[model samples]
Target: MRNAPLGIFDSGVGGLTVVRAVQQLLPSEDIVYLGDTARVPYGSKSPETIRQFAHEDVRFLLDRGVKTVVVACNTATAHALPSLQERYQVPIIGVIEPGVEAVLADPQAQRVGIIATRGTVRSHAYQHALALRRTGLILHATPAPLLVPLVEEDWLDHPSTHAALHTYLDPMLDRGIDTLLLACTHYPLLVPVLSKFLPDGVRLVDSATTCAEHVKQELTKLDLLAEEEKAGKLEIHLTDLSDQFEDLSRRFLARSPGRIMRVSL
Candidate 1:
């Protein structure tokens, strides 16, 4: 089981952030990443639909022989994690809990700002998770659904992106949040642009990085860490393949994903 690949799935290309983190930290552990590009945005979907999609994703990964599954999509994590875990024998991890741990780690974060997709905000997953660990938390949640398409378009630093950021984040900034949580995996791609807009004292908390840390911890605790002396391989599966997604792969992995397989999920 130690040598079996770690499975990761997201609603779309955004989950690559989690992939990058896992690869960086656990170089010897193989990975299988599936991006449901055909149904890119799960944020607007109903909970039942999201849960169904997530179940299919888990089945696809499990069929490929993964020992663990990481639900990298915040929306799916919010609504589908419990069902996925209940039905599957493999251990499952979600993005929300790891992100909540990150926020609580910072003592200076009295007022924390959360920016994610419409569904994630509507589900109140982050808010609920944080409430369990902390008391009297001042939280501001905002939905920046536009950012996903912008990042997919590779408009990481466009003037239009700045305008959108201003509109989505201005209220959170006004709340004097010392820490801002990038709740969506795709938002990490805009960190350079997003950081520029943040006040000097406010720190950006990237859930992907923290989630990856949690992955490492979990694997280590279960004695599932790969023992291979050399770097592990990465296999990417997309529901639909395209030049744009191929192009974005470079941005996500710092190189080509190397032989991507287009599969319908």
Candidate 2:
């Protein structure tokens, strides 16, 4: 089981952020990634639909012989993780808890800001997770529904993206937040753009790095860490493929993801 590939899935290519982190941390562990691009942006979908899609994605990965599953989409993690865990025998991990853990890691945090997709904000997963660990947290949660589309469109540094950031952040800034958590995996890609607008003292926490570390810890605990002396391979599967996806994925993974294949769930 230790040599079996780790499975990770997302609504779309945004989950590549998690894959990148995993690569850097567990270079010797092979990974299989599934992107439900045909139904991208699970953010606004109904919870039932998101759950169904997540299950299909998981089934696809499990069929590929993955030992563990990582729910790399914030919306799916928020909505489907519990049920997914109950149904699957393999260990499953989600992005929400790791992101909340990142926020609490900062001892000085008092007022926190969360910017995520509509479904994640609606789910209130981050708020609930944080409340369990800390009290009297002044949280500013907002749904940046447009941000995901902006990212998918490859507008990382476009003036429109900057405007959208400003429009979404101005309200949070008013509440005097000291730490901002990028609640969605895709938001990490906007860090460079987001940092430009944040106050000097405010910190940004994103799940990619923390989640990778969390997965490493889980693998260690389960004695599933790969003992191979060479680097691992990454296989990317998508529900749909396009030139735009190919280009964006290259940017996110920091290298070509080998041969990209399309599969139906």
Q: What is the C-alpha lDDT of each candidate?
A: 0.91, 0.91
lDDT of 1 by residue, 187-216 (tens): 898888877788899988998999999999
RMSD (Cα, Å) of candidate 2?
1.0
Q: Which ten residues in a row have the lowest lDDT in candidate 1?
A: 248-257
Tens-digit lDDT string for candidate 2 (28-125): 99999999999988987999999999999999999989999999999999999999999999999999998898899888999999999899999999
Q: RMSD to native for every prediction?
A: 0.9, 1.0
Q: Would you give me the overall lDDT of model 1?
A: 0.91
